[model samples]
Structure formats: structure tokens, C-alpha cells
Target chain A: MSLAVQPIDDSETINPEAVRRDFPIFSGSTQPRRFHYLDHAATTPKPSAVINSISDCYAQCYAPIHRGLYPMAEQATSNYEHARRTLQHFIGAASPDELVFTRSATEAINMVASGWLKPRLERGDVVWVSRMEHHSNYLPWQLVCQEQQAQLRFIELTEDGQLDLDGTPELFAERTKFIAITHVSNVLGTENPVATLCTTAREYGIPVLVDAAQSVSHIELDVAEMCCDFLAFSAHKMFGPTGIGLLYGRQERLAEMAPLQVGGGMVDSVGDGMEESRWAAIPARFEAGSPDMPGAVGFAAAADYLSSLGHERVHRHIVSLTRLAAQRLMRIDGIRLLPHAGLPASGIVSFTHHNMHPHDMAQIAGEAGVAIRAGHHCAQPLLRRLGLTATARASFSVYNDESDIDALIDAIISAQRVFCE
Target chain B: MIAQDLYKETLLEHYRHPKNRCDGPIQDADAVERGANPRCGDEIEIGIFLQDENIRHVQFRGRGCAICIASASMLTEAVAGLSVAGTRILCEQMHDWFGDIEPAAGALLPNGLQALAAVRQHPARQKCVLLSWEALADAIDKAGRE
Candidate 1:
């Protein structure tokens, strides 16, 4: 199969107003004012194209895949495989067979830890992760290490909240068998240099898993260039539906791994005895059962929607909004933005007020029809490392404009006035 | 007016000048307990000095939202002079105050707790208003066991 890159028009400009119209949730509401949605890091609102694709699948071509010889079943199977290929190209994977569909990014990480790495690891082996990883990326390694009597190590963050690259070499000594880290932090908005980290881990014969849950929507990913052995991400974080996630692994590593779930669809041949049974092929072996067909259709639609917009343009738009929000939010008195080093924040800005609690701030923001997230953001260890219990976060997406940032700033000021006075 | 209605003047006053916000655990308290809202990381520790089956003194130390801190500050004042049985009744009343049904006739709330009625409008924050009272109940339970 030819893996050719699609041609994109570099000079195309993105009109966020036009893009906002593609999402019905923004306009169908009866509210007097527009809702300022700044929580894209949690989940994105679905576009009309993705929604229509899902409904069309159920209405026109609803059937079980890979089983029936009838026309409907064949259409469903083709659509599902096409969705896989679309995602494969989206992430620049070597082949569609490298991608395995899981329930979510959390389940994808769990599969790698239990099925791929657990059987190969020995007692006293070490798994290294960064301090800024979301709990979904951190807890799987922690649990597997505990169960296997292996050690779990953390690559600490510097004072500016980037990965402490200077202190990382000491944590990657001989016993380090696997390295799991996030490509971008959900809370601190720090984008780690995964390519550099992968190159270093490859030198030590260590397999690395990149959690791209926060990066796939904003940054273009190429697994070959990244040189990481495995990668995981969820579709919901992007513009697709929930309950669908993707895991990409190097062909050689995936070939050696066992299936996490053994079921009807995953069996190549079956007999009464276990010795007579063999698992299915690469992607099918991991999929295990009837797949989420509608989700796959929606996922492909989301991929097409983003591709049409061009990821380069998307990156520029989100980064510009993040920088603007950070600058304006910093001007507010008693509001402190979490420090980042040289790398700019990728569509997220987390902060705290010296006088008001984050929950109160978020509540006030919500009252003004602005949606933001407040709490530990499932990165309690990272917050504890920073000596903070909670922080308010405003994240951006392609549909978010400058007015959203203004609303967030106004809400913060309102909270300050209500509490500090 | 709307802002003051949410963060009422009485509530803000109590938050600014908390009655029994202390530096450490009460040195001579008979019972101590801690409560935390894991979702938001709001935590509070309550200590009670019980003498002659009455709450002689109550002190709290922790970090939390304004609603939680104010509720704790007001809680310390409300339960300080009450008998152990009366404290238990107040705990029951606090739980009832959060319910959809109103308190029965003649079931009066303590004076300072009225400010927290505003919390009912923000259902997401009811937990914040109840954190300190929950800790007080836990301390009373520990004292009973002792």
C-alpha cells in the first residue's frame, strides 16, 4: 500500500466564526449570550460532519463487520477498515495493521502495560515516566510495577514545569526496561520533546510509549520520525466521538505481544484444547470483539474534517490564542499563571488566584456562560510536586476565538471582586 | 447586589475573620478528625475538647474554598457551647438542610449557618458547605468511642 502525504494549501486562512457554525451546540441554545467553551482539553464538541456520519452509518449501513458475506456486512467492514487507514495516515503510522482500536486512551495504556510489557518484565525492572503525566498515563505503570515487584521511577520536572532533561539520565540506568511519558501535559500545558526523549531511550534499548492524548488534535504526529515504539491517544480529545481510541505500536513489538482479551473475533483457529487454538492477526487480535462501528465512522469523519482545515493552520490558531490568553490573564492582579520554560503553552493555560479558590472561580465562570475546568485535573502528583492543590484551566481549540479569552478574564475579575472585597 | 447575595456580607466577614482557624492540632483536644473533598482537594481538620459531655472548645486547621472555610469557622462557634447530644442533633440538621424537603416546623438552624443557605442555589457547592460539619460529626464519633 502506498502511504502518500496529501497535498495541503499552505496559504488557506481559518475563519473561526465559520468553523464555529459547523458545531451545532454553539448556536442551537436558547441562551441570550454565547457560551464561552474553554475546556477542549477535557473533550471537544462534535462537528456536524462527524455527527451526520455517525447517524448515516446507523441508518444506511448497520451490520456486523468481518462476519457476513452479504452486502451490508461487507460495506460495514470496508468502512471500519477505511477508518483505520484514515487514522493511520493521520498519525503517519507505517501501516494500518499497527493501529489497534481500544475503548479509550486509558484502556490503550492498560493493554500495553498488561499484555505487551508485563509478561516481558522481570522483578526489579524499572519503568520510567515523567512527573507531568496525567493519571491515566501514570497509574497503569504504577499498578503493573507493584504487581510485578518492579520499580516505578519518575523523571522530575524543572522549576519552570518542563521535563527536567538534565536530571533524566540518572533515572534511565540499566534496569529501565520501559519509558512511558505524555507528549503534552493536560494541566501545565507543557509540551515535552518526545523525539529527543525517544532518541535517548533508543540508545539504551528501551521501549517508549508516548501518550498523545493532549497532542494529537493540535500537533501533527509521525511515529517513524518520533521513533517511539508505541503511542496511544483518544478520539474524544480530538473532534471525534467518545468510546474510541487508537494505539500504534512498532510491528515487531506488536507481533510479539499477546491479546489482552481472548474472544470469538480474535481467534484464528479454535479447538477444544488450548494448544489447538491460535490468535488472529495483528489488529484483530487486540480488538477482541464486535467493534464500535458508528464510532469508527465518526472518527473517520473527524479526521477528514481536520485534514480539510490543515493541521498547520490549526496549530497556529490554537497557539496564538493560548499566547493571547496567557498574556491577558497575567495582567490580572493576584492571578498567577503556571510557569512554562522556553516552550510556549499548547492551547492550555492553568492558573490560580492568590485570594480565591479554583472551584469558586470556576463556578463564577460557569455562571457567566463560560466553561472551564478546575481541580487536580487527574494529575495530583504533578500538582503536589508544584505545591498546589487545585488550579483553574482554560484550554483552546480551532473554534475558540479571542472573545472566549476575554470572557474568561472578565469572569476571573468578577470572582476576585466577589471574594477578595 | 447579585454578588453580595452569593457571597453575602455575613459570609465574607466570616471567611475573612475565621473564628477558630488555628496553626496546628489542638493540644488538649479529646477528639480530632479530618475531612477532604478529593475532587477539589479541599481539606479541613477539626478538633474538639469535650468536658462534662459538652463541647468545651473547637478548633480547625486546613486549606479549602471560601464556602468551606467560612462554614468551618461558623461551625466552631455553633458547636462550642452545645452538649454532645446537641452537637449530634445539629449534625442531623445540617444533613437535612441539604435535602430537597424543607426542615420540619420548629426545627431552627443555628444563627451563623443561615448564610450558607445561599449554597442551595449552587448545588455543586453544597459539599463545600458541609465539609466542616462532616468533620465535626467525625470528631464527635471519635470522642464517643474514647
Candidate 2:
């Protein structure tokens, strides 16, 4: 199940300016600020095509799917299911039936924790999660572990914030039944060695879940290649609409799992007796209500947009920008990039100012129309480990340019003048 | 321009040299309350020493943004001689002051709380300005119970 890597013509180059033009938010009457959107890790703005697709679904092909018999209904159903197939190919899943539509990456994790892990776990079982996981990935497992009286263990991070893979042998002792880790640290931007981790977990017969919310857009993901049993991500993070997320599980694993929700579209039949209800097959069983058809259409459009750009091009562009940004930002007085010695981090550059609070820095930057995120970034534990209360993060996407980084640096300098000088 | 207005010279002065920022909890404090802005990890622990319903001494201990720390410092100085009821009124007044300021108009707030007026422009940061006041309110409630 290899991912379709579009051949990159050496003659061609990615024009971020051209990419930026595709997004209406960058050049519209209703545009917010100078729109140096450095907070791509938070949510990327929708491109015109994705936005148009969503509007087209609602306007031309609007109807309740999976139940209605009208032409509009059939069109809606086809469009919605077509998005599933697009996503299935996007992540290199074995089949569309293995994909479940969730509200967000947070809900996708909750679905796996509650539906799959809870029923099989015993009191003394252990679930190993990495310290760098976002709260979305951490809290669900914590809740499930607490409910099932299972121990939740954290794989310690190295001094540079990368996962300590060397320490894996001791951590994967017999009781470790499950492993949940992030493909990339949202705070540090360190891409974990997930393939190796998956391979290790497989040897121990431990099921692994990859939280790819941060990596789906930035990295070319192939769930089959990673060999992880489950993966979760959101569309909004990748320039699609909100309220649509993907939960990819291996077919065998999904078949063994019970549904997180049981209602309308998810039930094959509700028996006269309360205990005799039969669940629908794989993906449908997990998606209980009327799906976000328009959102699905938008998500597919986003996938198509990315595919057209080619992940190789996106990766190269971001990596180059990240390295340049990191080098430039590090030169500024009082700026400290989170230490990393392994493979260079992704497009995210999280740092703190010595003389100012991150919120203050962000506020100053915001006034200058440079949008960067400040705070723990829903990864409080990681910040605590880094000896920081909060940090201002400037994350990049395909749309971001070198000028955005310059604006961020200029904003930081200006903030220092106001706060420190 | 807006950023400078938010972190005024006076506010930074207070933040750098906070008034009544104690090393430990106030000795034999009547009330102690800890307030945190969970989103940004800003924390403030306030201690109040009350004598006959009057705030005899108020001290804050913790770290946060300039707005939060400055607000706490200014709040302690403002309410040092006020009764618990007076402090409550001041809290309400502060809330109204921020609430009343127009987003576009950079109006002057009352003397002690003028630094926080800029928070009204940045709605997301309003919590940083109010963290100390919330802790003070909690301290007052705990003091009243005692």
C-alpha cells in the first residue's frame, strides 16, 4: 500500500506567493491583519477551491446522505463517500472501510481509547504514551486508563525533546499492551522515529496509535508503511473545514473493536430487546449520525490541493524555511530554540523571550499583524519539561513565506523595545 | 502603537518592581488563594491579612505576564487600606472599566487600573488582566468565611 508520490519535475519550483493567492484569506476585503499567519499549527485557512467545494456541496448537491432516495441525496452520498476514498488513498489505508469520520483529532483518539482499548484492558495493563503528546492525545488515554485501572506510562524525552528510543526496551515490558505517540511534537516540532517505534511495538505485540494531527499536512503519511495499527488527524489543520477528522485503523483491529457510538447510521438493526442490537460494519459502525458531507467534500478538495502541490515540494519548502527561520531567530538576543540534535525539526519554531512573557510577545506581534501562537499550546507537560511556562510558536505551512518569518522577527524586536528596553 | 499602549511604562515599572511581592506566604495571613490562567500557564497566589474586615496587608507570589503581575501589584497597592466590601466594589469597578472601553477608542481608565485598560483591545488577554482580581475575590470569600 504505497503512497502515490507525484513525480516532481526538477524544472518546477513551489511558489508560496502563488499558493498564498489560492487562499482567499490572504487577499480579500474581509482579510484579517496583514495576515502573516504563522499559526498554521493551530489551523490553516481554507483555500478558495476548498471553500468553493464546500459551498457547491451545500448549494448544488445538498441532501441527507445514506438514507434519502432522491437524486440530490445520491449525489451527496457519492460526494461524501468519494472523500473517504480520497482520504483512504491519501493516508495509504488498506480500504475506505477502515476510515472513521470523527469530529476532530481529539474525538478520534477518544473513539479508539474508548471503543477499542477499554474493553480489552485489565486492571494492571499499561499504555505507553510519549511525554511530547498534545493534550488531545494524552487526556483520552489518561481517562481510559483511569477508568480501566490501567497504568499510563510516558516514554521520557531526550534533553533536546526527541523521544528517547534507546529507553524503549525497558519501557516495553510485558504489561505494555498499547502504545500511543505523536508523529511530531507540536511544541518542539521534533518528528519522532515512528516507523522504528512501530516496529519495536510490533515485536512486543503491542498495538500502536499515531496522532498525526501535526504531521498530516507537513509530512507524507502512509499508515501502511508506518505499520501503526491506528492513526488520527484533523482536516482543519491541513487547510480544510473544521468538524471533520480521520481515524484510520487496520481492518482486522477495527473489526475486533466495538463502536464508540451506536445510533442511526451505525446500527445494522436495533432488536426488540435492548441487548440484541447489531452494529453496522467497520467505518459506518463508528460514525453514528448524519456525517459532515460538505466538510468531507472540502476535505477531499484540500487533499487534492496538497496532492497537486506534491508532498515532496511542500516538505522541501517547509524544511528550507524552517532552517532559515531557526538560524535567523537564534541570532536574536534572548531568543532560545528548544534544543534538538537529531534530524532537524519541521517548520515549527517554538521559543521564549528572556525579558517578556510569551503572551505579551504574541500580543505585540499581533498588533503588528504577525499572527503567532503563545502559551503551552495544549502541551503543558512538555513546556514544564523545557523549564518554560509558555512559548510563542511560529509554525509554517505551504502558504508561508520567508517574509512571514521576517515579520515575526521584526515583531519580536519591537516587542523587546516595548517590554525590555 | 496599540502594543505600547497595552504595556505602558508605568505597567512595566510595576511588573519589574512589583509591590508586596512576598518571598513566602504572608506571616499568619488570614486568607490565601491561588489563581491560574490554565491556557497560558500564568499563576498567581494571593495572600491577604485582614483586621476588622479591612485589608491590612496584601501580598502576591507567583509568575505571569506583565499584565497579570502588574495587575496583581497594582491591585495590592490599591486595596491595602480598603475593607473587604470596598475591595469587592473596586473589583466590580475594574471589570466595568475594562468592559466599558471601546475597542477603537483608547480611553483612559482609572489611575490604578489604567494599565489594564489596553486589555479590552485584546479580548483573548483580558483573563491575564483579571487573574489577580479573581484571586483577590477568592481571598475575600475565604476571609469572610473565617
Candidate 3:
């Protein structure tokens, strides 16, 4: 593949004032000495396009969508259904029938824990998962296996944060049910070879479910080409609304999967007896109660906004920022940057100061107007593996500029000098 | 600068040239207490020289963030001539002192126990400053427990 380099006039590519004007929150913030935002892996800031979509949906059409018999309801239903189609196209899905909407990626994982994979899976069936998986992907199987009397296996990661392909000799066995892995490491910023991992899992006839929470916004994803059976991601992490996420399962697989929660909007008909009710087909089977139509509309708008900026452009910009941040951080005295920090890192830069507590470092950075995440970052297993209680993390996103990286480095050095001197 | 600047100066002095920062000889020691902050991987050992039921001397040995090591040194100096009740009151007073100061008060502690004042500006560093004291507290608690 020929690597393409876009010219950096910087001015034409991004209008600084226009970009700042888009987000109302930025208007009130002090702007500090230099407000460096490097926590994009946790959650992204939505643009005016997404903000307006939600507001417009509430202002003009705020009614029940599928069940109502009114004009606003018809328009709401049209927009909501169109969102499914939009997401389906975004991820290169074959049809909208495969998309199941849920509150967040955590809830989506729980749904699979109860609905599709759990009932069919029996005790002693081995589920292969990666060590680098976020708690969202790791904990569900832990709980599921505890109740079902099943077993969970862990795949090792190399020093560079990539999956150690040669170490997985146990993957080609009859006992293996499915392999669950994260597409990118939220802490390490390491990208996984999903297409390759998915293809290998198929050799043993095992389906793969990818935790695409970190990968969705950073890289171009083609679920059909990746050949995975299921994918889960949240919109909030991708410059979209919260309380809404997408669970992409293959049409054939979703057709047979059971529903985790059964309630209104999910049922075709119900008898006097509770157990005798018939559920709706495919996508509706997993969706229970009223959907977040307004949030979904905003999410759809977010998807469009990101696409307009060009996903490839966003990827290039963030990769460059990650490289710059990692290089600067690693050069600091007594600081150790974690493995796999680069141009296309998971968009996170994790480091530890020799004798400094991450919490203390975060506090200093906070005082410096440089915001970085501290502590275990909800990846306690990974932390325990590394024998650390906490770490300082600086993550980057599209809105972040080169000066942000400089600000973080400057703040860190100043903090070091302040305490060390 | 606030009176706490005095504390910051004390912390910098003790951290730079730490006093009572070594273990007492076994011949001169009663018992040693070991403590660690699992969060930041800081460890401290408290060696107390006691006479009958009263405290005669106190010292600390640890490797951790500068705040912790300095606080341990200053704490040793503050409680050197005090009774067990006096030491406990000092610890409580130090906690309140840290709570009362402002960041602009400067990095130094205001009073004689000024080495601990940097902790006031850094709420997150309070644990670091209190680690040795907590170990000392636990040592006393264990001595009483025994």
C-alpha cells in the first residue's frame, strides 16, 4: 500500500477560530495558559452538527416513533430507521437487520452475555480472550463463565503491544468456542490485526467478537471484510451522543440469537401467560422499550460530521499527535513511556515518572492546565499485570492540535522541575 | 507567601538534607515498623527508641516521592521530645495544618512542622506526607496491641 502524505498548510486544513466557535463549552473555559486536551480515548467532544441534530429532533419531532400514528411520529420513525441504515453503510454491513441498538458498549456486551452466546454455550467450552482487552470485554466473560461453569483463556501480548501470534498454539483446538479481543488498546494505543485474528479464528471454526470501542473512531473499519461475527462500540467515544451504542452481528447469527431483555416494542404479540409471548424478528428482538431516538439522530449526525472531515484525515492527524506526544514524554528525565507508542498508537500515551505517583502527576498537570487521565483507567487487570496501581495517560483526538502536545510536554517538565528542585 | 511557605522551606531542607533518616542500631532500638503505600509503591520503616513506657527518640528510613521522605524526616524532628499523646496530637494538628493552607501560601509549612506544607497545595500528596506517620501510628497501635 502506497502511504499518502497530505500537505500541512494547517490553515486550509483546519480553521482554529471556526473550530473553537463550534463548541459552546470552549467559549466559557478560561483557555488557561494553554488548555491541552489529551483524553480523547476516554470520550470525544461532539461538534455543532451533532449538537444541533439532537436539539432539532427535540424541538420539532419529540414523540414515540414506531408505535405512534401521528405526523411527528412518522418523521421520527423515518429518521431513526435511516440512522440504522447510515451506520450499516458506515461499517459496511450487508443489511440494517443486523444492527442492534443498546445503551452503551458495556450493556451491549451484557446482552451478548445473556442473549446470543450464553444459552448455546455449555460448561467446559473454552472462550479465548486477549490480555489487552478492556474491562468491558474481559469482565463479561468472567461473570458468564462463573455462572455457566465455562472456561476463559487469555492470549498474550508482545512487548510492542501487538498480539503474540506465535505464542497461541492452543487456538487450534476443538474446545475453543470463540475469541474475544479488542481492536485497539485504550491504555497502550496498540492496534490489533483484526482481519488476521478473525481469519485465524475461522480455521478452528470459532467465531470472533471484537470490542471495537477504541478502533471505531481511529481507524477505518469494514466488518464484512474483517469477517467477524459480532462487533460492539459506543458513539460517545466517537464524537457522538452518550446513552447510545451499536451492536453489529451478522444477519444469520442475529436471526437465531435469543433476546436478553423482553418488553414493549420487542414483542409481536403476548398471551395472558408471560412466557407465551412472541418476540419481534432480528434487530427488534434485542431492542426493548422506547429507543433513544433523539440520541440516535445526533449519533447519525456525528457519523456524517466525522465522514465529512474524512476518517482517513482524522486518522492521520491523531497518529501524528500520538507520535509527537510519545516522543516528547519519553525524553523527560525519570519518565518511562509504555510500549507501542507511535504514529498510529491507540491514540493514548501512557507513562510513569520514576518516583512520582500518577495521581500526583495528574494533579500537577491539572494545575498546569494540561488535562491527563490518572490511576488504573479501569484496566486493573492490565495494571496488575504491569505491577502498577496507577499510571498517567494523555490521549489525543481530532480537535487537539500540535500545540496541545507541546503544552503537555512543557507542563510535565515544569512539574518535574517544581517538585524535584 | 502564606506562613505555610515556612513549611515548604522545611520540607525542601529535610528532603535535601534529611535528618533522622536512617534506622537506629538494633542495640539502641525496641522494635521496627514497616509500612508501604501500595498505590505509589512507597515503603517506610520506623525505628523508635523508647525508655520504659515513654518515647525517647524516633527516626525513619524510606524510599519514595520527595514529599513522603521529607515528611518522614520532619515528623521525626517534631515528635522527638514528645510523648505518645503529644505525637498523636501533632499528627492530627499536621493534618489540620495541611487542610488549612492555600496553594499561594507557598510551598513551605508555616510553623515548625513546615516541611509538610507542600502537601497542603497538593491534596493528592497528603497520603505521601502521611505515610510514615501512618506507619508510626500503626507501630504504636501494634505495640499497644501486643
Number of the top candidate by TM-score? 1
Candidate maximizing lDDT: 1
lDDT tens digits, residue span A101-170, model 2: 8899999999889989999999999998998989999999999999999999889888877788787665
Local distance difference test scores for all models: 0.88, 0.85, 0.76
Docking level for model 2: medium
Better of 1 and 2 by lDDT: 1
- Model 1 ranges with Cα > 4 A deviation: A1-12, A273-276, A341-343, B1-6, B96-108, B121-123
Tens digits of per-residue lDDT, candidate 3, B25-61, equal 3245565787787666677888777666766888788
Q: For candidate 3, lDDT tens digit of each residue in A338-385? A: 767644465788998875667657766776677898767767777777
Question: Candidate 2 regions off by >4 Å?
Answer: A1-12, A341-344, B23-30, B50-53, B95-110, B144-146
Better of 1 and 3 by TM-score: 1
* Model 1 lDDT per residue over B70-120, tens place: 999999998888999999988878877866355451148877788888787
- Could you give the candidate ranking by TM-score, starting with the highest? 1, 2, 3
| DockQ per candidate | 0.62, 0.64, 0.21
- In candidate 2, residue A204 scores what lDDT? 81
Q: Interface RMSD (C-alpha) of each candidate? A: 1.7, 1.6, 4.6
- Candidate 2 overall lDDT versus native: 0.85
State the displacement of the C-alpha of residue B96, model 1, in Å, after optimal TM-score superposition. Answer: 4.9
Fnat of candidate 2 is 0.69
